[model samples]
Target chain A: MESRPTRRRFMEWFLGLGTGLLAVFYGGASALALWPPAPTSAKLQDMGPVSAFPTGKPTFAVYTAGGAQDGVFVVSQTSGPPTVFDFHCTHLQCAIQWSSGASEFFCPCHGSTFNIDGAVTGGPAPRPLHRHFAEVRNGHVWVGGLSS
Target chain B: MSRQQGPDESRRPSHLSWPEWWAERLGLGASWREALYHPVPRRSSVFDLLGFMTALAFLNQVVTGIILMTFYSPSVAGAYQSILAIDAVPAEHFVRDLHYWGANAMVVLVGLHLLRVFYVGAYKRPREFQWVSGALLLAVTIGFAFTGYLLPWDQQAYWATTVGTAMASYFPGIGSFLQGLARGGDTVSGATLGRFFTVHVLVLPLLLLALLGLHLLLVFVHGQSKVEEALPEGYRAKHRTGDHSDFPAGDFQPFWPNTVATMLGSALVLVAVLVALAATHPAPLLQQADPLNRANYQPTPAWYFLWIYQLLKLFPGRLDILGIVGLPLLSGFFLIALPFIDRNPSTQRRKRPFALAAGAAAMVFVLGFSYVGSSSAVGPTAAATTASSQAIAHPSFAHNVEPLLTASCQQCHSASSHSGGLVVVSYADLMKGGGLGPVIRAGDPADSLIIQALNGTSQQVTQMPLGGQQLPQSDIQLLSNWIAEGAPDN
Candidate 1:
């Protein structure tokens, strides 16, 4: 027997469809809004002149722009372009120290050690220290975002 | 029609009876009356009041949380200042303190409620779903704790959150995704604060309310459980299909007068405890977060999580997964599956001796671990001891302080660079000061601009070594002690 759809059943089906659509729309919207947005392209921050950094010595080069301060270690090699290391240690993101005596970078927080090339030498550091996108252009060091 | 013919209504014009009119349209009053008038076991003791007390504690949290939202600014730049502003006013500070204490109270009350339920074997057979819902409530309560912790925007809040999110990133496959989702970026910043505030205020509250509604509905449907020994012999088989009305009608009394009085008393006691704690010991707000000074601050989890914090220490490096992921999952599973796992229908404590013993041992372990975690030194305490002990009795301006400055500060503040119009290259140049003022005073380290900059305490001046890591405590102490000894060329 063919059954004719009543007004009550049709209304119930319509309401269910409306609710299903609303759930999908709200859930999708929330997920889209909450997911971390892609990082924007970073502006290059100037870290003083090439002459400020001495060869084989890692010096703190701080950049202050629009009142926000950020820093990096500019290690000027004897012959090659200077390499800039991120200020924070890879182990747990504490500031790393440069020891003139040992010529190694040490994380004061957890005792992780990194050599001049930013390679992890000892302690609980998971990997090598991260380097920033750096260049010595026009005799001044400019650092961009950290290398991927 | 004079249909409403009660003796109470006889004194008034029955046509304009507002209460009766509203109750007719709203239509929930009858059900509410019925629920309130339901019967409960006559000997319902103080332990039966745990669930009610927990709900009251949650209500207090909600009220205080709403009050806090009025003053709290979600942005990173304004958050710390807003907190300081709140703390400055005595009344506001008391409110904040109450909210702080209320959160801790909620956690404690919920845990106690769970324990009381577990001990009585109330989470068996018919009440299995209730136990599952209660377990989820526990998780939500903890979620509230974690999300609220970051709102203060202090050093303690920032670094603790940093370590916490980092731990979350250790989960097997979607670790990085979870970390990014929680942080709203690669790091804990303003975005993270915004996310936490939204969750703490909006999302979690809604979820908790829905769960609470379901939980309370189940409780009202089933009524309070009888004491383990009070159950009849064929209790399980007899009550398998809702045949028994709530519990055996031996000496059962109306839930209104019987349980309501006890709950109201407990609620009053909870309020007194919160007030006393808030008045005597106000909440702490540490210095504004300095990401660079992660070396200085020690980040510890809240007291409820102290056991897990200790567990992380026990299992280090690769095995950190065990403490962070494995244990929480294991405990959660055990809680949810408890009713099924212990299938013995007998609810008496003596009959389930092994289960009871195991639970007791777990309690001891948690308590012991929490004690150890509270005392454990996780940060660079070794550095602090050395720095304090070696606080140069007579620090030389020439030998001790000058060398330290030349290494760390002179790069930007030298004669040629002079980024801050301050020069630290020579002793004479340092006295002249910079763009701010005289960098040093003869015998006042506390008032000296140099000390203020180095310690990052001056609101007017930027932290010295600008974007770089803060000078080590020993180095800062050397300079301060030198200035105190009266700036002399030794």
Candidate 2:
């Protein structure tokens, strides 16, 4: 009678242990499925040179990579390196137009104003126009669309 | 016999001379006094002191919250400034840091207490209501943390509150309602801050205080439950044979000396820990809020709710309505109704499969959501895109007029379908014009629709692009150069 009870007790202990282990393992897996890591890089293609855009002027260009139009921007240069800024306003991502006489990037969608260097000059833009990194390579200028 | 009775009655204290005097004046029966002064078992230890420490932590929150409210302003223009002023107070930084670290410590201590209760099966039998109330208290603590998040009104606070309110909006039919309630309007602004202030200072604290009172009352009435024993076979046999009672009387010391000492010790340890945390890593200061700037905002919710915020982002827009609102509401409702759902007498972690499962799931979900949300905040970096010299050398006809049209007039005049029926797809079509006449007068770019749009002098119902997108100096110069260069199409 003692042996029979011992065997039953051992079995119950084993079952409980097994279930507890299983519960922890499944719970951990479920948590992992909920959160994922952020992406590191966005791909952008070369458009052309500083001279091609001309000084004291903004030129609108379509950004296409791998046969897709990802976004559009107005490329311009003032004193230093040529800068490319997204035509979209920072507030709502609405496309902005260049008003030559006013010398700023203006978003008609919400009346946001960005100066020649993409800094917020007036109105509702939360920040300066997002300026992408531009580099001069082999006499050709390239602007990267990633925000640092 | 008469002489002996008279002497005995004279010798006794007047307050205890009769049963009526004892019951009414001293306010205690003989049996109740015996129980109150009863000798307890010797198994009680320092680890059990966590309960009292948890209560003290809640009290600390109430005290610090009151101090903070004295200086905090809920307005958008003043909230950030107010926090700065608070930080500038004498020993204000230390106090703020302590409060911040104390809040975090409370969460950790409460969680540890719950774990201790669960392991010892304290949630079983008559103590079940206490267990349920403790859970509600835990939820309210987290709620306090959430409401306190937006008080700073800095970039981090602004965005964090935005994401938090967005998560609140994921609750089924009441999702939008909760969102509005959280924001006090359609968007997060000054009104939202005021509403959260009321909740953090008034609503949640009151609820927490009431629940805490009930929890302490239950503990006093029931006393501590006995810790489960690991009975050997022989002990079990004896128990089965009625040689031992199934329920052992809980071993505990009196509330005055032994228990209170342990409680005080735990509170001291918590203070030391908070001091260390505040000294080592104070809360970070961020840039002041500027309504016109939002480019580099990296908003993250408090650690407690990060998982929920992360979870909501996992669902795509198509499934957002359900993923964001429906499921969280159901879970919250279930949490509130947990006592009713769990009617079982056994509170053993091993026996309560459903409760244990739910707890484990919640833990995992929170961890996962936090990981994902943090990862997504950094976003993707862009690869270098070099401009082609070849394209510059052989400038297309499209480039020349494209800048002029896109810059000066694309805002109000779309190329695809003209606003006011004036399409400017090509130079010919532009010159042909719409209701207001030709956009470009051939070689005379000065007197043409091009010049009119750039100067904002057009009487075509509204200004070009109507309100803004003012042309840069360089862009205007480029337009003039192109026009002066005989409007070249090369």
Candidate 3:
């Protein structure tokens, strides 16, 4: 019983509303997928016993927080406090391995070398390896990967 | 028609007569074909083909850019990840590579076209506006390059844009305004990226399209200007013998086949070159940026802006404003106004001293700056090391020293916030030092950190910041005294 233009306007309005809702859903999904809510602070797990990392030598340990591997290499000095470092090289994300003979954490990918304290000692590395915040809790060593 | 259907009526379909069917549907009859083929003067040549191909390249950029934009995140954290996603998407790599190469090729082709127009005297008479418009288009092309540089949000993009925005800050009174406008705020951050993306994809594209339309319209309206030729005495006599006509059609061909062939051929060549570039030398990706880390940040401007960057560096800090902004603006204005300003009727590059000098200077400056800027490190390492040593030596005056160190030395030696890899902000970090070795030599003041830093005697890999500002005499003395005091942690 309504005029032709009025009916057409109502149909157009409904169509536009439907399109807007569809776009919002899709865009929101894409944004969420691209940037998942990463935790501000990830708790450190108990990465084995203290003797597992020997004195005056470096040991590699892998810890998981929220199902992601946070690779850490811990070096225990003979007479000083133990220093822990993220195994990822500063130049690129290549995994660094401990070379006792060379006395450094060497990255084969770009020849970047890190000293015992996780500082860059040689080659193309731009910065020292990142330090993992660690604490001795309940006679076990726990390391936090990224700070809040 | 009275006896039986006429030939025309019989030839028509049974449902409708030719004129009735045409008029009923299109509101026009069969007479439209005559108007459609109406002859227009043809002054275009193979040289004119570049403009058409440039248009086609822009269309490709638009299509590819839109597709890429669907996945692109204009955030510091998400920008690099989105690029990785684009690479992973099936067949998206080819499109992205094409867009990248197409942009570079468009700049090159436009440059050549402009040079050709200048040489052939096409900027004379009524076509001067087109010439000026072409100059603006060139600026827009460079603008596109600048905006696109930050989309990756890597260290290279960040530092490069930092240097670029800093250069923009040299524009007299409006310099800071333009710098803020370019960055969308005080510093390069999320807002800057968003603004750049919007301008690159939307605002600039709209302006380009409008300007290009005007350029083409003017080009068509005022036919290509011919090179001035010396006439022989017999030529005028021969012209008198023959019929004189302003409109000549015998030498020209139809626009359909010839122009299309030329345009298509150039486009094919450009596509082949772009494909070769894509297949052989894929664009390199640097490491993801960390806000807490800036050890290996190398700031290199896009190839087009390298010359200005280099020029700015050559000039002292006092004249940086003139070198960075004023000279470039004056040159750009002159280049755009060349057609109007140069009353000389000749179009030869050799004959145009001012234009030739400007062009040569620009080319040389850009090439030189790009090479130097890319090779140089972010800041002066020696100066930073000295400043840090001085600060450590004079812990009694740490408060006064901190600000001075940060302003003059933080670019290379400080790990305060996101300045650099080396942490010289505190006495402890200064003693710990950066890649070059400890800035403190413990209990040996004479053989201390300041001496080692100033002489670059440390065996640790590359020396501090490696390039940039040099240290002043007072700062050097301060470092010497600090090292002389056995590099105290206090």
Candidate with the greatest TM-score versus the true structure: 1
The residue-by-residue lDDT of candidate 3 on B146-192, one tens digit each, is 88877877766765666566566666787656766676554466767
RMSD of 3: 15.2
- The best candidate by DockQ is 1
Query: For candidate 1, lDDT tens digit of each residue in B237-256?
Result: 44544344555577765557
Which candidate, 1 or 3, has the higher TM-score?
1
Q: What shift in Å separates residue B375 of candidate 2 from its native position after superposition?
A: 4.8
Q: What would the per-residue lDDT of candidate 2 be over residues B1-490, giving only the tens digit for each residue? A: 4554666654547655465455456666453432333334456666577777777777777777678778778787788888898888756776777778878878878877876776666776677789889889888888888787777877666656665665565555675566666666544566677778888888998999899999988876666665223223243334333343442345534444554566677788887887888888876667775232223233445666556555544454336555556777677676555556767767566788876777778777777777765554322121000011101223233664575565556655676657877766666666577887766564565677656665566655444545544343234445555555565566
The segments of candidate 3 whose C-alpha lies over 4 angstroms from its true place after superposition are A1-148, B1-47, B226-251, B348-490
| Residue A73's lDDT in candidate 2 | 53
TM-score of 2: 0.53
Show how many residue pairs clash in every candidate, following the order shown.
0, 36, 2
TM-score of each: 0.75, 0.53, 0.53
Better of 1 and 2 by lDDT: 1
